[model samples]
Target chain A: SAVISQKPSRDICQRGTSLTIQCQVDSQVTMMFWYRQQPGQSLTLIATANQGSEATYESGFVIDKFPISRPNLTFSTLTVSNMSPEDSSIYLCSVEGGRGSGEQFFGPGTRLTVL
Target chain B: AQSVSQHNHHVILSEAASLELGCNYSYGGTVNLFWYVQYPGQHLQLLLKYFSGDPLVKGIKGFEAEFIKSKFSFNLRKPSVQWSDTAEYFCAVNWGGADGLTFGKGTHLIIQP
Candidate 1:
């Protein structure tokens, strides 16, 4: 297991603005995931960040709207572009220990409110 | 894509009472199941996991879950819950050998002392 930290625990932003959420891990992990959870809703996978390569986005999620960058194994950042009211949610960053059955460690999450 | 469904939206129980949360997934292939607990204002922590070998797995805080492969269900149960057990429980399912998980909507448990 690894310690995951996210910057800006919460933020209030106006519509049409963009915000970047950063996730830092204590150690290197093979797979780093980004998810979005609406208030009282289920978690939705946004993308998988791979070190030294482009991110793999899930269906219905576009790279232009939710761009992800993983410069290395220990760090990744997700930027939400052109925010809207519908974009308000708690964005979480998770790291899996290995491929198959290892437990995942999640960050504290960033609560974003777009008005 | 794999998806999980939690039957209960919220549950309330008195201290020392038994607790069970229903969770079902729609994945035909082999999968890994997990239960996570998130206390108020805290990060999600793993309660238990079922990877292989055993259908019944025990986790921390006296929690256990049975993975019914035939029914595609993994329900969490605690024999006797305490007041401190109040938290949100999420059931997650991961595809075999996959890196990410698909989480249920979550069940809010309130334990009254």
Candidate 2:
């Protein structure tokens, strides 16, 4: 298992503002992912942050709205740009346990409430 | 797109009763299944997972889940419950790709002692 931590555990932002959530892993990892859990909804994958390349986003998410930066294997960031009330959700970062383990360990999550 | 479905949105059970939470996936290829639990005011913890080999996989806290390929289901079960077992349960699936895990709408369980 890996210990993952996210910065700004909880934040309140106004509409049109942007917030960047940071994810730091105890050890180097190959895959880091960002997820969003809206109120009363399941967690949805926002993007997969690649170590030196641009993040790979899911079908419904876009880079312009959620720009991601993975400067190293142990750290990544997800920025929610031009936030709205709809962006109010818990943002979690997760790291793959290891190669072929098919397991992921998650952070405590950054709870963002946009008003 | 791969998706997961959890049958129950909320479950209320008394202590010492048998428990089963349903989970079904819509993927047609090789997949990995997992059940995660999030206690109130705590992070998500891995309850159990099924990658391959035995159909029955046991996890922490005496929780277990059986993977049935034909039915495309991996249901979590515990023979007896405890008050500490009250938590939100999420079912997730991964198909070995660049994509991340897809989760279900989670089941909120309340265990009455």
Candidate 3:
């Protein structure tokens, strides 16, 4: 398993502003996943970031709203643009446990509060 | 639509009491099952997983789950409960591939000391 970390552990932003959350992994990984956990809701996947490719966004989530950049295997960034009150949630980044390892290791989540 | 379901929304128990939380999913393919626990103020951590092999799999902290493919259920169990075990438990499933995990509405477990 790789050690993962997320920057700006928490933040409070205006409804129209944007915030970029960064995820850093201690070791290189193949695929990185971004998830959103709303209050009292299940975790929903936002996108999958693979190095050297365009990020794949899930249904109901668009790249324009959640732009991601995966420069290398060990790092990725998710920017929540044109934020709204509904966008306030915990954003987390994770890596598949490892090759043939089915588990996933997650980073300390980024708590975003849109006011 | 593929979804994971945790039947118990909230569960309360005392120390030394038996524990079991139900989880079921709608997917009908080879899946990788996982149980993750999130303690207060902490990130989600893997408790155990079942890809293949024995239907009964043991995990960390005396936790275990049985993968009953016929019933589309993989329920978590522990012989005894402790206050430290109080946390939100989430069940997840992923078809063997690049698909992202589908998680259940977590079960909140509160163990009284």
Candidate 4:
């Protein structure tokens, strides 16, 4: 299991402001992912942050609204750009277990509330 | 296009009672199933996972889940409930891709002592 940590555990921001959430992993991983959990809703994959490459986003999400950067193997960042009230959610970062394990270790998650 | 469905939204049980939470997935071909538990103010933890072979898989905290391929269902069960078992349980699936895991709506379980 990987020890993952996210910065800004909880934050309240005004609408139209942007907040960047950071994810740091204890070990080097090839695959890092971002997910969102709205109030009383299930987790939805936002994007896959590839080391040294552009992130691959899901269908409903786009790069403009949620830009991601993965400069190295152990760190990644997801920026919620031009936020709105609807963008308030818990953002989590996860790393896949190595060697085709298919298991993922998740971060504590950044709880963002837009006012 | 894959999706996971959790049958119960909320369940309140007494101590020493049996517990069962149903989960079903809509996907064809090979897939991996997992059960994750999230206690209040804590991050998600993997309870158990079923990749292949045995249909029954045991997890931490004396929780277990069975994966029935024909029914496309992986239901979690516990013989006796404990007050500490109160948490939100989520069922997730991965279909051998880079898309990441798709999760269910989650079932909030409450065990009253």
Q: What ordering of candidates by lDDT runs from best to worst?
A: 4, 2, 3, 1
As for candidate 1, its clashing pairs are none
The sequence of per-residue lDDT tens digits that candidate 3 reaches over residues A1-115 is 6789999999999998999999999999888999999999889999989999999999999999999999998999999999999999999998987654446889999999999
- Model 2 DockQ reads 0.71
The CAPRI classification for model 1 reads as: medium
TM-score of 2: 0.98
Docking class of 3: medium
For model 4, the superposed segments whose C-alpha errors exceed 4 Å read none
Candidate 1 has an lDDT of: 0.92
The per-candidate count of clashes, in order, stands at 0, 0, 0, 0
TM for every model, in the order presented, reads: 0.97, 0.98, 0.98, 0.98
lDDT of 2 by residue, A14-69 (tens): 99999999999999998999999999999898998879999999999999999999
lDDT of each residue in A72-98, candidate 4, tens digit only = 999999999999999999999999976
**Model 3 lDDT at residue A33:** 94
- Scanning candidate 2 chain B in windows of ten residues, the lowest lDDT window is B93-102
User: Which lDDT value does model 2 have at B109?
Assistant: 95
Decoy 3 TM-score against native: 0.98
The RMSD of every model to the true structure, in order and in angstroms, is 1.0, 0.9, 0.9, 0.9
